[model samples]
Target chain A: MSTRLPTFGNVGLAETLQNRRLLAGIVVFVVLALYPAMTLNAYHTRLLTWIMCFAIAAMGFNIVLGYTGLLSFGHAAFFGTGMYTVVLVMGRVGITDLVAVMVIAMVVSGLVGAIIGVLTVKTHEIYFALLTLALAQLLYILAVRDIGGLTRGTDGIGVTRPDFFGIPISELPAQIYLLGFYYHVVLVALAATIVLLWFVLRSPFGLTLKMIRENETRAEMTGVPVLRYRVYSMILSAMVVGLGGALYAVLIGHITPEYLDWTMSGEIVFMALLGGIGTFFGPVVGAGGFILLQELALSYTEYWHFTMGLVLFIVVLTLRENGIWGGAKTLVERLNDRRGEQ
Target chain B: MSSEPILKTENVRKDFGSIVAVDGVSVEFYDDEIVGIIGPNGAGKTTFTNLISGALPLTDGTIIFDGEDISGLQKYKRVRRGLVRSFQIPQIYDEMTVFENMQASVLSRKQENNRLFTPTHRDSASVSETERLLELFNLEAHADDHTEHLPHGVRKVLDVAMSFALEPEIMILDEPTSGVGSREKNAVMETITEAAVEQQIGLIFIEHDMELIRDYSDRIVALHEGRVLADDDVAAVMNSEEVNQFILEGGV
Candidate 1:
């Protein structure tokens, strides 16, 4: 084999740029980490935290729909499973440890994902999407009916903030004093999720997922077990979404059947698309933009849904379906091209 | 050339409802040979290759690859066993660059498709192999070009190159020169056949061009109405009365 690198050139420059991007990412994370300290408004900090949670979920949704080319209309199933697992483990099992609760939630959601993947991965196109919707709706109904009184029905249930490493975050004084502390915890989780997903998207497994997305038949002909990989994608995607849901449960400290509803799934999909479905950091950008937009719309009018919908329509049309981050990325590339020419 | 056949199909049949695409036609393919499959448009050539490649399930026969019955194996499993095939229309990832496309096949060949955390660009072995294939196919100039904008001939070459990247013992090319320009057809064939010979890969290609078939194939398998009419040396099959009457003259 030839020892020379492939003749694409700019290898050294690309590596330098990659390192710069990494440094930039770390700098951004540090700024986000210190934001709560800089801002006195707890509400804004909490909003940012909520955005991070949704970002996590949207990132997970991207793994399957964006990367693997499987559109799922029922991701709320895993997200809701995560939410309910956190609430139930804390309430029924009396687990006061946030770490333990999050772990349990992820495991439960992952199991639910695996089961749903087995049932749905065989179906293609609209059938696969519809099957997921059907399954998620089934879960929603179970939660709504409060089957065996486990979900507490439509009335929902409130969860007190659990202890984090014996920090007593549940106490009122601690809750006020350690509000930034909780925000920091969420920031750390979001950062970790980003790092993990970055590694995944760059990995061989991620490349195969993209192969499946680009051409399933070609991928199969090239020695990829398509069905098995789809299932694996489903499981991993669900676990990530589940982790997001667990964080969301902790952030909101309340659980309801609405969390399990199809609307919630739709919102997750919207978040992914708004940020550019397949691009790295797109989902997070989408989530952050979505939450901020909702917050802004809700403040101005009761017809916020109408306002948000109109904005989304305009954004979609203007971005040409590349999402906000994708659009921004294209702009940057264009600028760099001009600079190179000059 | 070899005493033992590397791939054998025993009475393999494919049916689409009541229509039999491929009849119970048994054939043996040995390593170190170039076999051309020639038939009219609707003949079972592509369907038969599909059966052997495990793209389509056999209706009533068995496919033995490397001395193992691969009748029930998945398409990818057949590929893993080095029975690879290129598509008739050049199936490729339009969104990915040519280099990435070749890298995908190399990754799959190395069984590294499941490496969840190692970035594909960081995979030195697969990357080197991808570069090698690109160089072998003279696709280095277009390595970074997205396949969507590639010429039809280049796309066809990329498809064949991807199959080659799997390091297959036997490679099937379904109308490899179809849709390629007349001027580029010979060049495409020359590149493919030369590479196959260099790598010692048995080639089974389907073609409509009689001259190309006669020039490249060591043997020819003539099919009409899903049945093998003649399976003999290229000269014998080309000269056979049935092949000329049904396939060359009337069939074409």
Candidate 2:
């Protein structure tokens, strides 16, 4: 038997490919970072911040649904849990540190995610989706009813901006400065999230999740503890989404029970599907596109939701289930193939 | 050769609401032997293997592997203890490349599947093991191709190759070359048996091809109607009249 391991022939090519992808990612982030300065439109920059928040949440949704093949329709539970955690902490505990608040929100939401995952990971398909939806709806009702007088009923409550590095954001000289500073905060968060997910998806744990997604039985026979991994994915995904919710709470400066509603869960799913479920960065694209389309439709007509529905229908029909990002990728590939042929 | 059997089942039974698919079958398998299981259609050959691999819960009986009772263990737990199985229909990750398919097994064997942050490609141990298995199975040329697009024979070889990556003390294969053409059956069998002997891993395979069985198996266990009819050396069992009448004559 040969004692030496064989070397991979394509190692150089693979490294070059990875370097190119890293370069592309850096370029994208650079453009995003420069957008506020170039446009000088505080309103538009703030809108982009909103998009980044949803992008983070939708990416979390994709980890479970697209990567692990578990369709969860109650992601709002974690999102809202994070939002509410911020509200409760600032209101009751009086801790207004942005970083501390976000961490607390994530830890609390992750615990909720763990509980839900433990309850629902054993179920499959629509049962899993419905169970999650049902559980989230229960939380929504509790918030609406002001359970234990904590949520303040359905009329909702306002949130004060937390301190950034001990500097009060609300005491800023102008609204643009405030929005710009917050935009950069969210920008940093989104960039960090993208890098984190990139590393995760390339990891062995991530590959095992993909294997489970492809064939659960085969994965089990190959010695994977399938259920345990599913739960871990759920907890990680929820924490990511929960972080987005923490950011959203500060950005919007308000809280409502509707954030926990099943409709919000559906919207999260729509973002993932629209961006192209299973493809990294697709959910981010989906969130930006969905938000922009909704804003455009709302400005044009009172029946904005109907317009949004029609667009979703058209996109689903034309894109062949790849969503916008995946469809665009396929189109580019086909175009390159044609050029090669010519 | 080791004085004690590596795997032993005590009157293992499986029932699907009184159907009794695998009825009170017990067998001992050693780490240095290749055992061929032969039976007619619906003779419970697959079910018996499934019981051993913990794919299905046994209605009754105990399975002791390496002298530890594993009857209540989960399928993946059994695999983690060096008991692994491949399916009849070539169960593989269709979307993954052939190299990745093999890498999954190696990752599991190294207990690295739970690693959350280490890049899989950088895991030199798993990557090299995967490459070695691809070469051993003569699947190196198609390492980059997705399993979905590969030919059936290649997929079969990949499935068995993946099982080999687990470094199991005992490997069970259900019809390892079922879908391959006749011309390539011997080649596939030869590659499998050679790898088995080289690795010093015991192999239990179910096959309908009598010639391949006679050539590859050190011993034969003939099952009929969910019961063992013959358990002896390949030549002795192959020449038995009961084995011939029940399994071979029945056109398995």
Candidate 3:
């Protein structure tokens, strides 16, 4: 097909890479799939659990930043809100139910998103990022001051392993037993997010988001609800971020106002951007790379954010981002371009 | 005819603080008809269009579309009911291709509840119809052309084509042929007219070129100082002494 714009390597190459959807899936699979290899190392296994938490959070951030072209600085609000919700649901409500806690966190986050959207959905460009960040700070303040009793304010909350679906999580050792459980749980959540988001990007609504990102006014003239869709996507995305927070609280046995901090939100934005934005698998790459870097760097220095910030700035200024996984596709495209030129 | 007004604006008034931009300007649009609103800059032509398209909140008045009062509804909701508007210049996704642009609009016509999860391919049967629009607009060759690379004329045409893909009951084109050279003006008008006539869609266009208003629009609404100085057949509106004076000097 001699279409006006050249695509990736015609049908022959596209057919061969038909398995490319596994690009993100296989990475998660390999990491989690091999957790049993370190059955004896408790510390290493525990570290991997934290990796999964940030990965889920990064996945959520990628939805709006990478796909919708909205850079949200208040994502940690939803993330931490979910964590707080989980703690309150578990401790105060006498509900040790993981499913119930997750559901509640998602609902709370969704409501928070709706409220934030009402204030800021219509604002885009640099204004959008600033507003989201402000909203995130609001969450942090509320956690520290407004709900001190329930949230434990600055001290945060401590809890034990969750009783997930009556799965007896406490009986499972932090290192040996629950590693498999966490590996599975995280992989499942990540995979489900990828599939769900992929569906969204391919759907009409996703197309509209991309359109709104590219040209808000044109999208409006087309009869697409520019503000509503933006708000809707933001809310849905924030809800997912909240789910990440809930999952994090369960995985770490803790919830804190720190989770609501803009710094935490900024880190996810870096993950979304470092891997690349507007590409399906870009933020996943950033999430994976960031987690790995943090894991490796912690052994040497406590100030890993400085190192990451340097890397991020370099990438932003110099790198012609095709995104992380998108980089591979770019290579193939460049090669195809050379061939076409010849 | 069946008692459903294609579009109706009753006592639509909008104010910017102390400045009244649109002062109770009432109008109606019908199926298969093209109406043009012409006025100088800041004549409230754009503001009036924005009000009807749900882009701006009116200070007062109700807008009825197909017998439904859509005065307070959102812009996208108005579009969902087949009331759409286009901007003066073509606004497009620079990263995507021309065909993708048309498809984007075509798919919106079938979006359910505006959720982003459902597959749009369920309605891919309409792809051929969209393709037919591309070909009719002489855009088939440039279907894959990135919007950034499109000539200004083609971009404007693509913008109009994308608007048509929505197949709205009434399309408000804000300066459809604004920037393009005279060479491509006829081509743009040809496509716009074809869609408006075939789909029985009502078209309201704003043009600075009185000649085009004289030629294409079934009727012309002339605004002077945010009030309709003339709303009549193109001949009468153009020949009115007040209109000639307003154009030659300034608002009445």
The numbered model that scores best in DockQ is 1
For model 2, how does the per-residue alpha-carbon lDDT over A47-150 read when each residue is reduced to its tens digit?
Answer: 99999999999999899988898999999999999999999998899988888999999999999999999999899999999999999999999999998999
Q: At residue A232, what lDDT does model 2 achieve?
A: 93
DockQ of candidate 3 (2 decimals): 0.43
Which segments of candidate 3 are over 4 A away from where they belong? A1-18, A23-31, A38-44, A97-100, A125-127, A145-148, A301-303, A320-323, A335-342, B1-5, B8-27, B59-73, B113-123, B248-252
Q: Candidate 1 on B1-252: residue-level lDDT in tens?
A: 998899999999999999999998989998799999999878899889988888777889988889999999988988998999999998898789998999999999998888977777766777877887899999999988999999889999999999999999999999899999999999999999999999999999999999899999999999889999999999899899988888898746
| CAPRI quality band, candidate 2 | medium
Poorly placed runs, candidate 1 (over 4 Å) = A1-18, A172-178, A339-342
**Each prediction's Cα RMSD?**
2.8, 3.2, 4.4
Pairs with steric clashes in candidate 3 = A66-A278
Show the lowest summed lDDT stretch of 10 residues, model 1 chain A: A1-10
Better of 1 and 3 by DockQ: 1
Ranking by lDDT: 2, 1, 3
Q: After superposition, how far is residue A94 of candidate 3 from its true place, in Å?
A: 3.7
Model 3, B1-252: lDDT tens per residue? 325558999999999999999998888788767898988888899999999988799899999998889999977778878888777877888888777788888777766326566554444454566678888788989977889998888888888788778878888898899888987787788778887898888889988877678889898899877888898988888889988888635532
lDDT of 1 by residue, A1-342 (tens): 333334434568667557878779978998888777787778888888899999999999999988998999999999999999988898899997989888898889889999999999789889998999999999999999989889889989887778887877677475463466677777888888898989898889988999999999999999999989999999899999999999888778779999889999999999988898858889999999999999999999999999878878887888845789999989999999999999
